[model samples]
Target: MKLSLKKIELTPPQILVIGFAAIILAGSALLSLPIASATGKPLSFLNAFFTATSATCVTGLVVVDTGTSFTLFGQIVIILLIQVGGLGFMTMGTLFAFALKKRISLRERLVLQEAMNQGSMEGIVRLIRKVIQYSLTIEAAGALIFSIRWSFDLGQAKGIYYGIWHAVSFFNNAGFDLFGPVTGKFSSLTAYADDPVINIVSMGLIILGGLGFVVISDLLDYRKSRRRLSLHSKVVLSATGILIAVGAVVIFVFEFTNAKTLGTLSWQGKIWAALFQSVTPRTAGANTIDLAGMRQATQFFMILLMFIGASPGSTGGGIKTTTFTTLIGAMIAMIRGKEDIVLFHFRLGKDRILKAITLTMIALFLVIFVAMVLSTTEEHPFLMILFEVTSAFGTVGLTMGLTTDLTDFGKIMIALMMFAGRLGPMTLAYALGPKTEKELYRYPEGKITIG
Candidate 1:
């Protein structure tokens, strides 16, 4: 008799999914420990799992108040999860590899390429190094600013701790806030709504995080290279600015007289609240206003923004800004009777257009299906269910007061949605499907009717 072992190979997408899931499970285990709870009792496994999933996915929807329910050790675990999730596990792996002076294998590079959503493996290592440098630099600056402002409000020790915690949270777009003791549990940034310093710094961190690291790298390199921005960067920047501006205006207009939200604020306060609210809805879940009190129309509009979400390779999620831009470009091209979709004088390939459509359609279906399920399983209103579903699918973390009241089933489903959204629907699909094989011949082209 002979003993034999078979080696198993995993695709990059499979590796990413498993990596995130493993981190989430480990985080859950740590959180479930007695020391992790504020009251010195182990948190429920379900609550811990949900919290871990939310943290690891960088989706901030919480069943337990993070600041009130968890101890310092727990919060540190959460912050670590957010950092890894925001940067992707591969990025952290690369950091460890660097610390040990170990070479990243070719297979690891391939996984990194997929994790970062890069077009090629070339310069992947360099990009990861730059990502580390840029992320730490930005977070440090934000933390310094926060500490300076908060030192007058709180003692020096508390200010520094709060600064580091929140700076990381905001920069990673994690939306996890420790304002529970100062304000109220689940209050998010509402206490700082009128504070110009808080509003500006928070929004800046969110915007930078949502812009995607690749775009940041490109912008940084532009000064040295003196070349035009890549089409992807151009589209991301344009879309982000336009969305923020439009979202701000719409929110200000709709909530201008809503007393529960913006009406009680001064003119300056109103502007700050409106701007911050607009920015946070796009995958940054920190809210300066009472989201549940916002006008239904405003909430629905935010749902759209949440769905469009942040750019690719960004800490934030959703179908991605590039996907949205590509779909819009394709629509415009079709309306103009053009043969190809063009942006910045560059024609997009058919594959790119098809991928965008597929991604958007899949995302739409996922949100809809989850919303339907939640609506049926929970006692919340349909709008609230839909909002939560979109938030989960977009990894946006915005909610209409439905998260804490969720049944266990709802929590699990939402957690799964968060996981799917973080890895991306396409990646999951690819990972589960059979390996790609080129067809010998193409099928005949067919035409379809249009509206």
Candidate 2:
């Protein structure tokens, strides 16, 4: 196939913003069609738009039930959006480009770098190829397992279809689920709270998806070559393990006496639920237990986990594991009266530290501002509003029963929050800002502070 391509003048960040918006809008339109609904009546455009944004952003918050409300076409549309959104539009486009044997232009490479959050254009194309390859293999294995497991209960054909749908959703860190019929509407995976197969598989998919592609690739290569892991991979793994373990412990203790949550489960069930909850908060929205029923302390702890979120270049969103780790490292350096922020015996550059601080600040402000706005627009309690806002900004779908009650204005706000979260607060700032101007001059800095 011969292809003629004209140069696009947009910056990488701008292209990403535009590409994601395009997918969201197109998805919204399709979902609004009568054929997309289970009832054969057109879903309101607002609901359709919200659902599309949630799916494309891979945020699981939903105003409507996924299983009973949509026809097979709508579900298919959603899973496709999740796949494209999770891997990123550029990745899917690159796959097509590879199939067509089209040369990847420098501009396209730049876009890919930004899309994957890679530091350089070098080896970007190769990395993307590995990303797609690894993602498909993982999703296929998950789907086969889910299909076989579900076959006995749902019939072979339904099991297969659901298996594929859920595999895509889970592996993408998108919390969309079709258990609405089996469980109640918006019940998520509560029905499988004690099912080891379901809980284990769901957590496995989420963890793999949350671990960024680069880390995944590095781990795989390390296994083959018996090589030392990259510092980034080491920090990511360390932080991830610590967070999960701590979160599980905290949740287990906090919810142990609460009759509505972990208290009623068997000892083994409680452990599974605790672990699952811990993992899900890192931008994987599938919940095995009732989030609303959990103790407030546990909910707040999960909020912190959600805010730290998944690793960079992964399907999940938030400030990112690396950024959180960097901030903590910087804090430790300050406490120890050291001039350098060190991680794994290596000194971190000022630029990296500054970027981490900037990203966290931007994310924090965005989340706070959105929460304030929702507080005024909706009648929910301040805590619930904050949780909803943080969940949207973190692109984590866990909610305390607030999603269904949101006003139209509130819904739009949450949708925009999800958009910003998925693209990243810093990236959105860059895409919307004027051209960067290099300052040729600098003034001396003076600071006065009291601790």
Candidate 3:
């Protein structure tokens, strides 16, 4: 048989995979340039590749110091990658299309539809516009506040630049920071642990960015509907509120007497630090205190929080808040022996519940597999390995001094984990191979299970 010139069509997942890979490659190439480094020397291939992947994936697990290693040119490249990764290239394309007054075809709409995790193609163009506008508005406000504080420290021009960089970093939930101290390396926000402005602005940006665009749009539309909100909006808001509050309390209780972490702080400072750490680990990677100084129990709990991560369709990575919430609802329904799963007085769909469970299981399997791999490859404590693996899988970027010490293969393992985590476990699974066939035939059901 002779083949004609037929156009090849790619599935949404395939398109997404290709797009992300292309971005990562381009970023790596750019960062490999000598001008990207402050030392006027190009980064090692592996280091550049890892940084590029992390930035493009919006995962901030950098092998090098983001501040001193890279020059202003390199920093700009990283910031651009973060913005594109956080909002997605599809949104960027849509914006460009809008600017050029070009007509968006069905194919473009379909891609945007998948990118936004929307139910349909309606209003997607408009939605992207709103997302850009809203995100910039928030970043501008946050940048202004940060600039005021940093201006006093870094001087006028440098301060504004630093402020913009961090504003973009936090808003994207990318953990990369330029605050590596002259004396203390990779200090993060520890120097300003007692500073209210830095803590509040950073945490607030992370929370808002992690809320997901759909939730933001829902709330914006709520007033028109007599203050009514969608079930998703309500669930996300409730879960986020509960998690932040409970996490703060747990961290405070666990680290209350730990001198290295919280004991040295005054009462108000301790409370603020606890709250900041709690909120940061769930999604964002920035921390006001040294994570290694915290109690082991707090670190363990942080792994759980990191695994759950930010809300679905957000810049942040992990299994997502809704997935965790759905699992909880399912468990509650099972204990009650209810045939239908319910949350917020609405009946939960069976398909959604199955997706949640499957995603979580896949995520758990990935984390454990990586941890075991790291154990063999890295000569670190088992608990620390677990923490690093979970952190990479969640794209949370928080490390227990294990990031820089990873050997060659270990770095690759964590890099792959970060890529998978950024795309999400379920999404990565789907991209690997989605069940495309429909079964019209049904066989008799058989059940045999004992736990």
Candidate 4:
């Protein structure tokens, strides 16, 4: 008798996880090459892996100064990684599939659906094409604005190069910057803190890029379909606006007299810095103010914002605006003794609410657990350690100047956090969990008490 074997198959989520890991590893290998560094010295395995993780995750955390440490060639690689990471690997794969005129298989569409967090597999190819086209167009426009402003400052060729570099970085919400040397290494956008042109353009790109592609698609369909905003678009826009306003106000209130971050600035400069700081911390890692100088209250507030992060299907990471809003909806419904979680006069599915809860719980668990691990490895202030862990978990790269001092083990811990942050707590869970299960029997329900 002949023996029979079963074929192995990967779930969409598992494929996504594997795909991102594969890309990060490849990027790490390339970045570790001697030619990839400005000093002609290749980064050690840990550093290279950290940088690649930062780039591929679009988290903007760096072990080395991107500008002073990497050559133009290396910078290009980093930006390319950001581009791939920002748009997501599957989104790019679909675009390339279209470019090659290859038929997108059903499995490929399913992967794209999962990657994009879409409701269905329908029109995934077209959606990806739109995402790529819109992304490039927006990035090009941003680059042009930057280049025009810097043409005389840095000369045409170099200015254009710098402009394009930052445009990509800004749109991707990756805070890796070449805007250093004049001030301090890894100084970020502090040198141009008061430059309205740079600040406005970069912030605009960050906001637009952070807005989920679904929202963009819905907006574009408005004129053609004559339909109102999708529920998701409405929730994301409303929450994003409120969060930004609240964050700016809180930052302004806390740092008005700190004399380090928002203080001591010209009145106009203060407002701009405050607003920029408020916006950037929410998944955009660029900073015009010293985060370390801000009060604990302000930093803690920012940790909340970072934990909420960008909306789903956007370049930036976090539990997501939808998840946050859903939790609130669930709470409100419970308080009112309502059976359904209603939002904007729409009843959300129980499954979605449960998922939101699950993601949040897992995220909190990861943050607390990792922070504890970090506390053991380093002798930093507890709040600072918590801040760093939350930042990594949110994929927001703002640090309290503690990233460079981390031990090897600490670096690994943060890297893991960044990876988990980018993939998402639930994504990691599902990706690593069993691929399939059959539940043919039901068990008696048990009630649990809650405060």
Compose the digit string of candidate 3's lDDT tens values, residues 1-451: 9979979778776677789889988999999999998899999888888888888878788889999899989999999999998899888878888889999988888888887777788988888888998899999999999999999998989889889999999999988899875325778888888888998999999999999988888888888989999999999999999999999999999999999999999888998999998888776888888899989999999989999999977898888888889999888877898888888789988889998989999999899988987898899999899999888888888988998998989888888988888877766667788567889999999999856
Rank by lDDT (best first): 2, 1, 4, 3
How many steric clashes does model 1 contain?
A: 0
Candidate 1 residues lying further than 4 Å off, grouped into runs, are none
- Candidate 4: residue 179 lDDT (0-100): 71
TM-score of each: 0.99, 0.97, 0.97, 0.97
lDDT tens digits by residue: candidate 1, 340-362: 99899999999999999999999
- Clash count in backbone of candidate 2: 0
Report model 3's TM-score to 2 decimal places. Answer: 0.97
lDDT of 4 by residue, 1-451 (tens): 9999898798888998899899999999999999998889888978989998988888888889998888888899999999999899988887777888999999988889888888898888888888998899999999999999988787899789989999999898888888765468879989777889988998899988888888888888898867789889999999889888988889888899989887789888888898898888777898998888889999888989999999998988899989999998888888999999877889999789889999999999899999998898899998899888888888888899879889999898998998899888877888888766788999999999989
* Each model's Cα RMSD: 0.9, 3.2, 1.6, 1.7
True lDDT of residue 293, candidate 4: 86
Cα lDDT tens digits, model 2, 1-451, are: 9999998578999999999999999999999999999999999999999999999999999999999999999999999999999999999999999999999999999999999998899999999999999999999999999999899889999999989999999999999999999878998888888889988888999999999999999999996767889999999999999999999999999998888998899999899999999999999898988888887778888889999999999999999999999999988888999999888889999999999999999999888888888889899788888888889988899999999999999999999999999999889999999989999999999899958
* Cα misplacement distance, residue 46 of candidate 3 (Å): 0.6
lDDT, each prediction? 0.93, 0.93, 0.88, 0.88
Off by over 4 Å in 3: 1-6, 181-183
**Clashing residue pairs found in predicted model 4:** none
**Residue 232 in model 3: lDDT:** 91
Backbone Cα, N, C clashes tallied per candidate: 0, 0, 0, 0
